[model samples]
Target chain A: MQKKSRGGIFVISAPSGAGKTTICKKILSRNANIKQSVSFTTRKPRKGEKNGEDYYFVAQKTFQQMISRNEFIEWAEVHGNFYGTSRKKFEGLVSSGFDVILDIDTQGARQIRNSFSEGVFIFILPPSIKVLRERLQDRKSNTKKDMQRRLKRAAVEIKDYNMYDYVIVNDILGDSVKKLEAIITARRMSSDRVDPKWIKDNFLR
Target chain B: MQKKSRGGIFVISAPSGAGKTTICKKILSRNANIKQSVSFTTRKPRKGEKNGEDYYFVAQKTFQQMISRNEFIEWAEVHGNFYGTSRKKFEGLVSSGFDVILDIDTQGARQIRNSFSEGVFIFILPPSIKVLRERLQDRKSNTKKDMQRRLKRAAVEIKDYNMYDYVIVNDILGDSVKKLEAIITARRMSSDRVDPKWIKDNFLR
Candidate 1:
């Protein structure tokens, strides 16, 4: 029988410094069936970060226009920057049998889950609050006030982990990656996405 | 955030002549995390089938004793032979943190699914009735009457395809394995399995 065309979607959310981006990248690289869904962000690209690759860097005006046009599947405002995922791209990928992985914030993850009940949601956690803080501070990427703001947000974000389908405590990168890979492998074996159409076509013939 | 364990059981069933066994074996071999629970049967071993590997072959007397004690998770009669899965073994594997795959007939599969409402279930179908017959004939393992019996049973089995979580047609071995793999991967990624205990141990401290 020909392979089924239905694709799966997975959402990964974590605290800002929780290494979710790294894990998500590892997943996409390892999985042939999965592709990363780039978010359209109004925030300017950080130093050395490419525009289209890192984020679909869009203008504030363009982001607002897209929002008004119902182009975004989910959108969020983080630190004065507008970030959104394109609905068309996601729908296209899924319809064409491509499992899409979205690395988004808790709010955006929730929105996507509600909108797409079949989407797989994975929550990533730092080993500890202390470790999370230390990691954030070690980066020296933000001022003390910014770091404090992130810490407060992390506390709130941690509470939403219960809402996710799978949780990974990212204490070690390799172990977390293995767990993530396992999750992907297992989900593909799930019966929900396999349509009876294939069976009908195969057997009824 | 700690990872949750979506520890749902997956019951796979098909007629004797269907490609379910081969398909299941391929899936188990490729997916390391999924454990195929060996079932106990009172039936005499077929040619070249190993004990404890293909089945937990037991005497009829011992099988009846276990059934009387309610040791079976699920049990049913097929072709005058009794077959059952050990309840304790299933629980032990699950509690020990392994996701399980139960390869059984439709009746036993139904029993297990009913008992474990959270379990995942799937039905595998042959590409066609003709193909099923051909496969049985090719094996030359069954008597003429036995082959006819199996075909009849297959017809009855197909009726329950709608009752399963997923219906897969074993049209191609590799593709079917991929689809089955995806289902398991997605379920593991489900929100219910991602326990927050790891997060509690790490983050709370």
Candidate 2:
């Protein structure tokens, strides 16, 4: 008996305001076979957020315990709150042949790369630094100092784009979504993912 | 000053009756930036086949002269007729940033692979062996013996599918076309092809 082909993991990272979230959401809506890996977070859910759907909202104690038990594939502390992706959940999705998309930051993407080298790492770039700054300013909540700090961090993160396999400039939302979808579709058709048994049965026989 | 990104070479190969020609035609028609590499052939052009469009029809002497001059990137003699691709033309197209698609057979593909290692090699498969046999039979010129020989050759060629970067089973015409388009788009977005100066100007500074 031949082993089944495992699904691929697509890791997408971007600096803030690069529109990675919107592109990922569009991809998920169009592709039923692709699932988003909902993270576990100790941060309190905002309005309309659902536990286990948006995130596995757990208390800080539970998050710490899970980290201590080594259950998280990659976990990080951000803004004084913990966010993690469950190793069990991720492996389960992939083993069952469902493509999983992880929308993460550059740091989280780095950790995932260390653990899962097979994953397709993609970096999303805002059209320009000026555009990114304008988008951040439009958020209405960030103070001047906060905006400057975020911009600095974004510049630092953008330098890591070279580490990724593919990069998409988020100038237009629809175009970026299509490019993301293309990446997912093309990755599905890679020769490495084709089942040897299927090839034998269809052509060799 | 940053160097311009060169265009990619997409090499597509398939067994006889696998519908590679039709798929390539559709891709060329839809994509304006892509140009087909018209091969130089010593064989007489069939009815309705234009000299430069379908192929570059040349005399056997001319073909041999060009071969001696080392102008052909790859060439092969089959059934007393010679076919070759121009290395200079291909490089010119790529340098001008126009993606070039070469539709060749498995043997020709293998030869090109040795010369152009950076090309994206894609193999197209029929829905199944049964479908391939039927397609060959549908060709009115093929005798029973010819059909059988073609089927045998196809089986041999199919094994080379593993060597390709991407594989598409031509089960549905529309689906296969989309997959091919996706591969091309995703490849264009690869980090290797990105202009570093654009990154530095737009994000770093």
The best candidate by lDDT is 2
lDDT of 1: 0.80
Model 2 segments more than 4 A misplaced: A1-5, B1-5
What DockQ score does model 2 reach against the true complex?
A: 0.84
lDDT of 2 by residue, A49-91 (tens): 8998889999999999999999988887765778899999999
Chain A TM per candidate, in order of listing: 0.93, 0.92
Please give, for residues B159-197, the per-residue lDDT of candidate 1 as tens digits. 677678776667788877876776676566555655557
The TM-score measured for candidate 1 stands at: 0.81
Tens digit per residue, CA lDDT, model 2, B169-193? 9988989999999999998888887
Task: Report, for candidate 1, the interface RMSD.
Answer: 3.8
Model 1 residue runs over 4 Å out of place are A1-6, A30-33, A172-175, B1-8, B17-36, B48-69, B96-99, B122-131, B165-190
Worst ten in a row by lDDT for model 2 chain A: A1-10
List the candidates' TM-scores in order: 0.81, 0.94
